[model samples]
Target: MPKLIVVAGLLLALTACGKESTPTPPPASQTTQAGSGPVDVNVPVEMRPVLSVDPPAQTPAPAAPDVLTGKDGSTYRVGPSIGDFGRFENVGVEQVDGRWVLNIELPDDTAAIFATWTAENVGKQLAIVVDGELVSAPEIASAITGGALQIAGSFTQKEIRELERAITGK
Candidate 1:
């Protein structure tokens, strides 16, 4: 009947409208798998000392100084590359409490050096330098005698991998 034909047409139209469109492919740059290979990032990191006031250094200070500005119009400095990451033995990323953490392990001798440095610098902050940029300046609670340290940040999996690759260079 004509009524049956109209109902069929309506059903057909509804079904057509319910269909989902094909998804567009992601950009080529974003399709890369994390930790698959070297990621081209300019943010190379280095450990630097933190200072409340700029040191009495000569003009054109170190090629790069990690400067952190606080919301209260305060400025802090971290530099001289005290414990460069180049001496690290291994770096890995892990998830803890649904958050990403970067674990850095150093050799025995390097560990001792860090322990001594941290012990002496207790109650101070160590600037996490990344490509002349200060990412974070965490205070030293206790001496890091274990030679292994963990950096906890609310980073994504991709970011964690990128940081691991950046620091390890592997």
Candidate 2:
């Protein structure tokens, strides 16, 4: 039996079958550009806790620079702390179900941390930061105990490789 899981915030759909879960792309409203952005591409990937989403704050806080304003004019805020499992052990793109998804492998210890964070923060969103930009903000639907995860969004082949290089530092 396949167990379906959702990640990537508003732009993720992944299906798990026999321990292999591949992601599916979201609708047109939300797409991810994990690499190409105006910000410097040298920054490492981080998962910061989302402070707010849509309907921008009445008076933006100090972390205004960290605000992520989408093309649709929706805005969101993320915590300053780099809250995440840890640096990924492996990051690469793969094709599944006719869509491209970013596959991330975490170390056992980091995976444990991720599991805990997810468990505690269910319903909260995480800012998937890649290359110093908010590439995705996926809500935590449930605890992800598995050592791996997939981020589904639109990315060109160049963007995918660029993201991998930035994340892997290779």
Q: Which candidate is the best by lDDT?
A: 2
TM-score: which candidate is best? Answer: 2
Model 2 Cα lDDT, one tens digit per residue, 1-170: 22233443332342221112344454342334343222222455677778876654565434456776532344767787544433555565665555555667676777777778877887677666665556556666667776566654455556656645655545
Instruction: Please identify model 2 stretches exceeding 4 Å from their true place.
Output: 1-42, 55-66, 70-73, 80-86, 130-132, 153-159, 162-170
Off by over 4 Å in 1: 1-45, 53-75
What is the C-alpha lDDT profile of model 1 across 77-161, one tens digit per residue?
6557775554555565656556565566676766777778777885566665665554455666556676766554446788667
Query: Which pairs clash inside model 2?
Result: 9-138, 9-139
Q: What's model 1's lDDT at 100?
A: 61
